[model samples]
Structures are given as C-alpha cells and as structure tokens.
Target: MNENKKPTLEICLTPDAVSFIDLTGKIAVIVDIFRATSCMVAGLASGVTHVVPVASVEDALSYKSEGYVTAGERNGEKVEGFDIGNSPFEHMEQEFKKIVMTTTNGTQAIEAVKNTAEQVVIAAFLNLKAVTSYLKSQNKDVVIVCAGWKSRFNAEDSLFAGALALKLKGDFWWEGDEILFSTHSYSSVKNNLSKILKHSSHYKRLKEHGVENDMDFCLEIDKFKNVPILKGNILENLAK
Candidate 1:
C-alpha cells in the first residue's frame, strides 16, 4: 500500500494464507459469495445503516444487548437462538437499522485482517462491479480476501476473487500465482457460473442445509451498487 505508482493487487485464498500477506494500509475486499458477503452487499444496498461482522456467535450475541439485530450461521445453517440466518434475501428484507452478524467463514476472514488492512470492504458477485469500481477509486494496494470454507480453500470465493481480479486487470499490478490460478478458474466457468458453481462444495453443503435457493441470488452479478466498507468493525455503505 505504500507504493508510489499504481497499486498492486493480490489474492489471499483463505484465512490461513493471510499470515504471509501484508495487508498494512491496503484495501482488503472480503469475498464470501455463498452468503455472508452477499448478505452484506444486499443489506447495505437496501438502506440498512451498518452491518457489524463479528468472529464468533459469542461476539455477535454480545451485541444484542445494544439492540443490534443479531444474525449468524454455522456450517451453512442458521445458528440457533439468533434472530436471523446468513441469507442475502433475509438481509434484503431490511427489517432492522443495524445488525451484528457472524458466519462460519466470512466473518472469520473479516476478523483476520481487520487490524492489518487500512480498509476492509465486504464483497460478492452481487456487487462485483461496485467493489471493483470502489477499489479502482481508492488506488491503494488491493488484497481480495476470499473467505474460504472454515479457513480452507473453497471454489466459490476464489471464483469471486478471479472475477474481481479480471475486472481490475488494468487498474493495479497483479501479484502471485494465486491470482493467475483464480483467473483461470473463473474463466473456465464464467459462461456457466451458476450451473457450474452448483457443483461446488459450499453449494452442495448449503443444499444439504436446505438453503440452496440462496445460491442463485448470490451469483447474480451487479445486483447492487453499494460497497460495504468496514469502519471500526462495522460495515457502512461506502458508495452511498
């Protein structure tokens, strides 16, 4: 992020990989296409004030005392006792002014780089163009942090990183084989993104959890224009 010329773009495929990536002063776009980030984009675009992303259910539940509507999920299912699940559609409803949410993967990734990155933005296929545009405007070193399943690599998030990287092709200098690998991954399935992604592990896992319907909406591109940028652990729409 301290570079003088055009910024560099890098991809962190999983939370575990964050150890090697220097996010200092960089803009980290957190991608969790299956649901979490999709929900963040959807909620912010729909006029919700802020979405607070917490690392664990305990962290999320603690916010309840302050009147932040609580929402969360674990292993693809809504956590018991929470007011809502991690679904973009549920977020689209906009039942509350603010929310504190946690997810099995996405929130964990957000927590990973919150302290290191200069700015953390939530992203998904739902707001691909918005996120890409925002990053271009920032003109800072970019790290596309894919919230892989449980701190491990997952196809959907990497696919999202690929699509975003492809969009930012001329804006920033690309770095590492991870970016190359993701770009190829996205190009291979771009024509049939939804159909092909239906075979992904997280997709199949959500199906087993009875929330497979969320996948189609999550994959819908450019459905929103707002980019949710994290401010002190709370995400507020940056584009608005």
Candidate 2:
C-alpha cells in the first residue's frame, strides 16, 4: 500500500470539532472515558440485553413507561426515580431488556454522531481492544470522537482516544493534524488511568457517592472483549 494512500485514522476531541465527517460511509468510534463508555462495556459484557442511548432525560423517562429500564445521570448523579445510574454496577443486576441511558456528555456525543458515521461504536478503556479490532477489520478511514466533559476538554477521554490512535497508528494512516492523530503511548494511558478519578467531576461525584471503584474499573485497559456498536437506538455487540 502506498504510504500516502494507506487508510487513515483521525481523532477528534469533541463532536463539534468535526461536524462534517460524513458518517454514512465510515466507522465512527465514540469515546466518553469518564464513564458512559465504561458503563456501556460493562453492561454489554454482563449480558444486559440492549442499551438504548438517549440524548435527553425526557426521552429516557418516556422510554421507561414502555418497559425500557432507565439508566441515566445528570451532572453526575443518577436521575431521580430511575432504575440505574450511569455506573456499570447498576446494570449488572440482570440483562437489561431495554435500558434508556442518558448523561451530560456521553449521551450527547452519541447523539451528535447519530447521522455522521456509517455506524457508531462505543469505546472506552474496557473495550479499547475490541473497538480497535473491529475498526481494523472494517478497513475504512476511522474517526475517534471523544466526548469530553461537558463542552470543555478533559484528559481522560483524550488519553483513551490516544490509546486508540496508538493502536491504529501503524496499520492506518492518520488524516488529521499530529495532535489529533498522535497521543501519549498506551503506557501513558495506563499511567493516567488513576488520574481519571482524581481529575474529573464524575470521579469526584462518584467518590462522594462512595463509588470510587467505578473509576478504577473504567480506567482499566482491555478488561472486556465486547465492542458495543450503536444500532438504531440501541447498542449491540459486533461479533468478533
């Protein structure tokens, strides 16, 4: 393959940064390192039937009456009167037939790429390997879109994107600038694993709620082998 013509990998810090990447013909990987992607990996790996990601709390609530189990967080707390919070532990009780999940950043990021990628695959530290394997198999130009904290940049998500970028670096050519295409090595991602808990509102909130372990779980690399791909309104695993 010609060096200039090799398939490329482009990482974006947020969805707003690259709103023009046509999602119809390419794979879009969404990473919300704080917890949504982490919770997604745990939920799917634990056999929760299907996870339906919604952009708004109202949408999630509406789905609740339709037999959809609700799992959501606003700011960082579980939605009031909801079945589960954004934590993976909350969804481990049983196979969630249909979980309406929402969050401040992750959910919106998923929604942002709803019409962009040919398909949206959820990525986190837990499923990084799974996501990378799936992307390599597809052999298409890929975009790693990070769902940063609120609208501002966050280190954890960037590190996760970096990890993916590092994996995709050799096989796929990078299309964006060096900063987007390159990141600290996987070792760096591993080193900063604990920092996600130390530096983010999600960690602080979960710590306050006595769920510090969730952050540790989220930061672990390749703990899960499942890749949650956004299908229609629900997230389903791609057979590896």
Candidate 3:
C-alpha cells in the first residue's frame, strides 16, 4: 500500500494486547481516561511540574521519600500511604513536582506497551486537541490503547478513543471495528456531552467519591495547549 493506502489506523480498546507496539514503526496513544491521564494533563497545565510514571504504588512511595510528590490509585481509591491519589485536583497543589504515579489500570496499560512503541503518549479528554494535532503530524501507523478498568472494558476510555478516531479517521485509515467505540462515543458526546457520561461507571465512581466536579472537568476538551508524551520514565510536555 502507498503512504495514503497504508493500513495505519488501529485502536486497542483495552490494554490487554497479544503483541506489544513496535515504537520505531508506530505511535502509541495511551488512554487512561478515568483520571490518571486526566490528572497528568491537569498537573502539567496547573504547573505542578514533571510527572514520572511508575509501575506500582510501592515505586511511587520510594519516590515520595525522595521529595517526589507521590500519586496513584488502587481500585479507584487512593493508596493508603501515598501523598496523593489519582485525581487531577489533588495535583493542583503548588508542592507538586516530579510526581510518581501508578494506578490499577492506567499505569499498567502504559507499562504494557512502553517497550514496544517507538513513542508512547498519554492522552485524555483534557488535551484532546493537542493530542489530535500531534497524531496528525506523524506519518506512522497509530494505535490508541485504552487503559480499561482492570482487564475489563470501560465506557469512558473507549469514548475518549472514539473522539480521537472520529477526528483522525478523516486523516488516517483505521484497522479494527471494536476500537471504533472511541469514534462513536465522540459523536455521542458531541451531541450531548453533558448527558453523555451520566450513566457511565466512571461517572458513578466520581459521584460516589464526591468528585463529580472533576468528571465535569475531565469531559471538557482542549483545556490545555500542552500534550504530555512519555520520554524514558518521565512525561515531557510536547511543544505546541
């Protein structure tokens, strides 16, 4: 296939992948929509400083004692001994710097394909336009891996992926049908974003946790001009 004809568009709705990404050949967009990526984007935009993605809560704790503000979640709750949990609002603090973060699903999904992809990027609804712009500039095949809750599928991640797909489909050819949830969900949200997440488990989780406002914040698009891409073990702000 020619450059335009190359089979380059693919969306992995869940982090469970049989093959790891070959970063030298493809760009991997990692989505951990139920707030890890959201928090990262928020932290950066809020001027919290650098974010370091870790594989475990223990790893984050190790960094905490070293002055890195620690953040993560397990089963949607903040870890018992961390300075912070996986919430964007929490990172808004001025003390935030070199955040070491892990989460049940988000971080694992990131670690899952970190070694395979040529470039690993973190994505969230908060920086949708920034991510879409970067994806447009790359000629390589694109794979969007949604960090679902545990090994199970969640509506929010796919919905965020759908938004990316809908915008990307006009420019890149897609590979699978199931991953199209992101595109479809994007459309649904566009039509009714306020009500789009009313029934989602993520929304329920937030409401139960008394953080409904953060959910509203996450659903907003293009709030920041900066996109965070993983470079080595840390997240770097991509140029606007």
Candidate 4:
C-alpha cells in the first residue's frame, strides 16, 4: 500500500455488512440499482428539489404530513397510502418539490452509514459518469455500499459497484472481498446491461408487479449528469 497513491476503493455487498467496515473518512456511495438509489438519482436529475430517504414507511408518511410527496415500495410493489412507488420513470413523469421515500434495501443502506462516513452519495447507472468524476476529484477512499435485496447480496447492485470499481481502478487501488467479483460482473455485462438486469432477481420481481418500464429506465447508463449527495438527512442535487 503506497501511502502517496490515491485512496483505495472497497465494496460492501450488503447493508448488513456495513457495520463491520470503518467508514470514518471514506466517501460512501450507496448503490441500489434495482430501483431505490436509481429512483433517487432520477428524482433529483428530473428536478425534484430534495429527496428524504427514510428507513420505513412510517417515516415517509411522517414527512408526507409535512407536505412532502411520499413514495416507496415493499417487496417491489408500491406501498399503500403513498403518492408513488419506487420507479424512476414515475418520478421523471412529473416534477416534485420534495420527495420522502423508503424502500426495503436502499434507504436502509443510506441510514446505516449516514453518521459514520465522511460523505454519502446515491449512485445508479444513470449517474455513473458523474459519480465517478466526483469521486476522482475528491481523491478519497470510497466504499460502494450496495443496498442488497433484503440485506442479502444481489447481482445488480454488485454489478454497479464493480463498474465503479473498474472506472476508478486507474486512480484507486481496489480493495475488499467483492472487488474482483464486482469488476468481473461489470466486464461481463457492460455491453448488455439491460439484458443482464432483466435476469436479476429484483428485476424479475418488479416485472411480476408490472414495472418493467421502471427497470428499463434504471438500467440506462449515464442517463443524467446529476449526482445526488446526502447532506444531513436530505439528498440534494450535487450539481447544485
């Protein structure tokens, strides 16, 4: 480990594993590729003012009481009594002033590291280039935390993490158990991202619920130039 070299990159394949990692000075990029972080990135990129990611439906509802637009999902379906579901396409269809959202994995991952990490940002394929660029500029050790399905590992998030790992390899030394797997995953599906996503567990679940369009929207690479940064408890457009 060269002390003068750029900071190393690591990957935590699931939120449940986050506690074991020391995130004190690292930049944590939360990846929930199936939809949560994707929707957050889309919401901000499509002009949503701020995104408040909550750990549960109760929290989202609480914010809704304060006039926030509530959106979330449970098991890949929209939660009852909410304004919308976890769909980037739905978010892109209209502008929202503020969005309060919760999901099975994504939001939970965000909450897990909010206090420990030096900075937290939401990443998806839509903002891949932007996120990598920001990370490069900061030159900080990065941990790509995948909000796996129900605290378990999932391919989509790991693939995105691997893509980031590959993109940053030139500037950062890759570290962690899943780094090689992630990079391999990225290389295997780089040209056929959507096709590979369609075969993912969460993607199939979303399809059963008739939200394949949302899945399609989420798999698009670099669809937006914006990155969503978590400031305190809110996610604001990094470009702002």
lDDT of residue 210 for candidate 3: 78
TM-score of each: 0.96, 0.90, 0.92, 0.96
Residue lDDT tens for model 3, 76-145: 8888978888778897787676788989888888888788788888899888998888888876678888
lDDT tens per residue, model 2, 142-199: 8788888776667777777877888877888876663453375434546656853486
Q: Model 3 — TM-score against the truth?
A: 0.92
Tens digits of per-residue lDDT for model 4, 145-233: 99999889998999999988888888998877699888987898889888877888888877898888777888888989898899989
Q: All models: lDDT?
A: 0.89, 0.78, 0.80, 0.88
Query: What CA RMSD would candidate 3 show?
Result: 2.0
Off by over 4 Å in 1: 1-4
Query: Whose lDDT is greatest here?
Result: 1
Instruction: Assess the local accuracy of residue 28 in candidate 2 as a C-alpha lDDT between 0 and 100.
Output: 79
In model 1, state the lDDT of residue 208: 85
Q: Rank the candidates by lDDT, best first.
A: 1, 4, 3, 2
TM-score, cand. 2 vs. native = 0.90
Cand. 2 Cα-lDDT = 0.78
Q: List clash counts for every candidate, in order.
A: 0, 4, 8, 0
- The ten-residue window of minimal lDDT in model 2 covers 178-187
Q: Which model, 2 or 4, shows the larger TM-score?
A: 4
Worst 10 contiguous positions by lDDT, candidate 4: 88-97
